[model samples]
Target: MHNATVIALRTVATILILATFVPLLPFEAWYIRIFDFPRSQIFVLAAFTLLIFLVLRWWRYGIDKILIPGLVASLVFEAVNIYPYTFLSPVQVQQAPADAPADGQLSILVSNVYQHNVEHQLLIDLIQEHSPDILLTLETDSIWQKGLRPATDSFPERVAIPLSNTYGMHLYSKLPLRQTRTRYLLEEEVPSIKTYVQLRNGVWVELHAVHPKPPVPTEDDDSKTRDAEIVLVGKEVKGSDYPVIVAGDFNDVAWSHTTTLFQKVSGLLDPRIGRGFYNTFNAKYKLLRWPLDHVFHSDHFKLVKMERLPHINSDHFPILAILSFAPENKYEQEEPQPDEDTAEEAAETIEEGKEEAQEEDD
Candidate 1:
């Protein structure tokens, strides 16, 4: 190969490899954390770069020292980070018990209906069509709440906290709700809903719906608040004796460090473990999508069904999941357990969030 061509290839490969290191830094800035959303894309790019380097390289110079090792490391890191979300990985949550009666099943639909989105009827129609037992909507405001009221009238039990700041939440359930409250976990402007709902079989299940602010230049400068809110929920649900379900657009990917910590701390299992990345955000861009919407459950519930619904004029695609409460299947699934380091990190993150909130209050 020509000397100029060799130099160009080495430079390109080096740049790609270096880009993968952004997520490894122990920083939560939006510029760095955004790298965590595209591990799959990064893996594809790194693998392609490695293949090109292998086929076009010569042993003429010491280029091998810099380019080859870097490319290899990048490929390995990306693959390891994204491997769990692939089909080759083992399922984290087991299927619902085959013999469990239909009465034990709970169907839920969660959507982050972008506030400025004008197509309110699309969401209303979807709700009527799916008729899920519980409907949780985020990014809702007064206009959205009023528009959806008629369609959701059948959902007699409701909790609505409408705001125009794009942090609104509304939860409607057909089942009877016991002790439902809208709490501001970290930021008072951001609301989270917690309630105990009765299933058809007269069994009670605790449910939490949350939409933490995304770590972006426009939304939040860092991920501390988002991480803290998620960690707090995880810690709260960890010791719960009742079956628990936490669902919504978390504004973070399933494989992120904070999310993994959340699962381990809460003893919750993501239904997308062995399943494909049901990429729900950035509905307009196919390649830029990730699984921002999630449905996690405790061991007492098994997955009856899970799916990513079609896009509704919003930037996010809705998610629907049906879970069955069968104690027998609890042993079939494995729950995540955080090691000493992760536990300590979570506690520190929560404390940091508390201090920041206090400063803002003062």
Candidate 2:
């Protein structure tokens, strides 16, 4: 019985250590990339395992001496990945002053309404209560389109692309939207909305609403398309003359390598940094959740308020953020820039994604 208990702990420790290093590999395979989503969970588990070792005085054994060090190293690695999202780190996006001008403010609400869920009224009520200047909904099919019409009718300017493929997207804006274009960045069936939104102050802010195909067995089988799409958009937004805001269900966690690269390549600020994780996905399960839905913006804006809203019977809870446009204060915040190596890596990822996409077509 004593040997069996020792063996069980050893086996669990080995699995945790391997899981920690697998995501560090430069592979785009779904199995490998999926490991990037649960750093927080891994950190908790590693800490718990370490506690067990300490309580049992396992370090007295030779085998445990090796396992304990590996567990400690894993904790350090996971902490580095998730540290920026905690309040202990400085905020990437500064907060707006209490006297921030109303006209210069833009409040956006983003929701990934699971296509099959028909609790349309609950979503509508939430939208009405929040009254964001912009509302972006993902997984909107024909049924969702019609169902959301009552709430959307108030927004004079809109873009609706309803499809049954679960990649459908809709953008409703109370403010005027100019140069609105529905683009297929990487995958033909997947659509992303791009437009210039004229704020009440007459400032035109470029907005990109994207819902990239995730890397799952039922989906593309890898994250190449998703990573490529993200990198391509990051590069595009990098040189924009106007302030930029990119929001949607990225299907990627905030702390993942690809998301960090996206921020560096685009020079955008993540408001969640130094605030909290603000996990938005897996709304039904508290134990398994990550910040899959995100809103990234240029340093021209400062966060006023950001929160995860109540669930609307969907797999993802809606996220609402109000940002004050204060470009003059942009110098106060530091924007992340891609170095030579990061630039080269992003370019290669984009090319690989295009090649893989072509092969699929053929």
Highest TM-score model number: 2
Every candidate's lDDT = 0.88, 0.94
**lDDT at 27, model 1:** 87
| TM-score between candidate 2 and the true structure | 0.98
Worst 10 residues of 1 by lDDT: 56-65
Error of 2 at 308 (Å): 0.3
The alpha-carbon lDDT assigned to residue 98 of candidate 1 equals 71
In terms of lDDT, model 1 sits at 0.88
| Clashing pairs for predicted structure model 2, backbone only | none
Model 1: lDDT of residue 283: 90
Those runs of model 2 whose alpha carbons end farther than 4 Å from true positions after fitting are none
Location of the lowest summed lDDT over 10 successive residues in candidate 2: 1-10
Provide the clash count, candidate 2. 0
lDDT of 1 by residue, 1-362 (tens): 78798677777777777678887798888888888898888777778877876775533448766677887888888888778888999988877757778899999999999999989999999899989999999999999999997689989998989999999999999999998988998888999999999999998999999999899989888888889999999999998879999998889999888999999899998888887789998898988988999999998888888888988999999999999888865877888978888778889989987776667668
Q: Which residue ranges in model 1 land beyond 4 Å of their true spot?
A: 1-12, 58-64, 97-99
Backbone clash total for model 1 is 0
| Residue pairs whose backbone atoms clash in candidate 1 | none
Candidates' RMSD to native: 1.9, 1.0
